[model samples]
Structure formats: structure tokens, C-alpha cells
Target: MKTIVQTPDAPAPIGPYSQAVKSGSTLYVSGQIAIDPASGELINDSIENETRQVMKNLGAILSEAGMNFSHVVKCSIFVTDMNNFAKVNAVYGEFFTSNPPARETVEVSALPKFVNVEISCIAIS
Candidate 1:
């Protein structure tokens, strides 16, 4: 059976979807934008800040599932601009210093809220 994960520390889904879902020992986190959970404001002032918020959002979901970055096995990063890739990577790298999860970063046409970056991950406990 699968269990739905939710946490007040993460921004509420703008649509109809769970924050994350867990089956067996694996958890699949949904894509996270830079919306601050406390204020529902998009953190778009800079790529660094936006990516940081995205990671925090992802972290909140992982935490809710009793996991952390170390538990992450894979990650998908989406960005509207390739120019921001390095900036985003810098912030994302801060979370996974060693034995980082396998990941792919792609440039997309756009994202929800028109935010520059979005991230999702798969983690195992």
C-alpha cells in the first residue's frame, strides 16, 4: 500500500496532488517551487534564493517521510533558463555534499508560477 505524505512546513499544493507518496521504503516527492510556506510568496528575487527555497520545500517533504538528502536516490531539477543552472546548482549542492543523489537538471520552457527553478526527488528510508 502507498501512504500520502503531508507537512505544514511545506507549501500547500496549488492543485490536487499530495506533497509526496511512499510505497514500501521508497518515497517520491513532488516537484517543489520557491513559494514560502509561511507567506505563500514566491522567492524569485534571485536564482540562489529561489533554489534554496525549493530545496527547503523538498526537505520539508523528506522530513515528513522520515528521511533527508542522504536518503535521496534521485532528483530532477527543472529550470526555465539554462543561464541560471550554475546558480541553482550552487544552492542545490549545499544540500548534498557527499554521496549525492543521482540527478538530472533540465531547461524547461516554463514552470508553475513562472518561477525559475523547480525540484523533485526520490528517496528511500
Candidate 2:
């Protein structure tokens, strides 16, 4: 069976989608931006800070589903500029220590809120 996951620790969905959905052993997280859950506002002005916030948001969702970064099997990262890839990767690496998930990073024409980075993940439980 499939289930939807929601948590106040992370930003609420901006549209019709749920924060995440679970099917059997895997959980599919929706794309997360840098919006803070408490204030419902963007968290940082710089790409590094914004990327950190995005990671934190994803962490919160993963925790809510009883999964951690180690359980993540894959990730998809979208960035406004490829130039910021290294900085984003640094912050992202802080979460996944070993056996990190397979990932793809791409430069997008634009992102919601024009944020520098956004990330979505898939985790197994």
C-alpha cells in the first residue's frame, strides 16, 4: 500500500502535492527549496546558505518517514547555475557520508523563487 507523508518540521507543500509519498519500501520526496518551515519564507540570500536550508528541509522530511540520509538511494538536484555546483555539493556531502546515493545535477533555466538550488530524493526503508 502507498501512503502520503507530511510534517510541520518542513515547509508545507506549495501546491497540490504532498511532501512525500511512500510505496512499499521506498519513499519519494518532492522537490524541496530553501523555504523555512516556521516562517514560510526563504531562508538565505546566498547559494551556499540556501542549499543548506534545502538539505535541512529534506532531512526533516526523511526523518518524518523514519528514514535517514543513508537510506537514500538516489537524488536529483536542480540548480540555476552549474557554477555553484561545487558549493552545493559541499553542503550536500555533509549529510551523506558513505555510500552516498546516485545523483544527477543539472542547470535549469529557472527554479521556483529563483533559488539557486533545489533537491528531491528517493529513499528505501
Candidate 3:
């Protein structure tokens, strides 16, 4: 059966969606923005800071599902501008030491709250 995952450490979904969903040994996390859970506001203005917050948010969801960045098998990143790609990747790289998960980064017209970056992930236990 499918199981829903959530964590108070992560920002609550602004709409109708669970923080993550687990099926067997795999967990699928929803896209995470830079919104801080406690303050309910974006963490910072710079793409680097925002990307760090986004990674933190994803980490919370992964932790809640009994996983971590090492367990992540794939990631999908969305950015408002490709120019921020290197900065975002720098922050994202901090989480995975080696053999980082398969990933795709794409520039999009917009994102929730018009945030500069957003990321979602899938991990296996």
C-alpha cells in the first residue's frame, strides 16, 4: 500500500498535496521551494541562499521518510533562469559527496511564489 509522509520540519503544502509519498522502498518528494517552515517565508533573496533552503526542505522530507541524500536516486530541479544553474548546483552538490543521483535541471518561466529555484527528488530505502 502507498503511505503518505510528512514532517513538521518542512513547510506544509500550500495546496492539496502531501509532503511526500512512499511506495514500498521508494519515496517520492514534492518540489520544495525556499520557504522556511518556522517563519513561513522565503529564506533569502539570492539564488545560492534559496537553493540551500530548497535542499534543506528536501532533506526534511527525505528524513521524514527514513531516507537521505545518499539514498536519492533521481532529482528534478526547476529554475527560473539557467544563469543560476551553477550557483544552485554548487549548493546542491554539498549534499551528495559522490555518485550523485541522476538529475535534470531546467529553466522554467515561473515557479510557485516566483521563487528562483525549486527541486523535487526520489529516493530508495
Candidate 1 lDDT at 27 equals 99
Ranking of all candidate structures by their lDDT, best first: 1, 2, 3
lDDT per residue as tens, model 3, 1-125 = 99999999999999999999999999999999999999999986788889999999999999988888999999999999999888999999999889999999999999998899999999999
Question: Quick one: ranking by TM-score, best first?
Answer: 1, 3, 2
List the global CA lDDT of all models: 0.95, 0.94, 0.94
lDDT of 2 at 12: 95
Candidate 1 residue 84 C-alpha distance from true site, Å: 0.7
lDDT of 2: 0.94
Cα lDDT of model 1 by residue, 1-125, tens digit:
99999999999999999999999999999999999999999999989999999999999999999999999999999999999888999999999999999999999999998899999999999
Residue 52 accuracy (lDDT) in model 1: 98
Each candidate structure's TM-score, on Cα atoms with residue i matched to residue i, is 0.98, 0.97, 0.98
Which candidate's TM-score is highest? 1
Q: Which ten residues in a row have the lowest lDDT in candidate 3?
A: 43-52
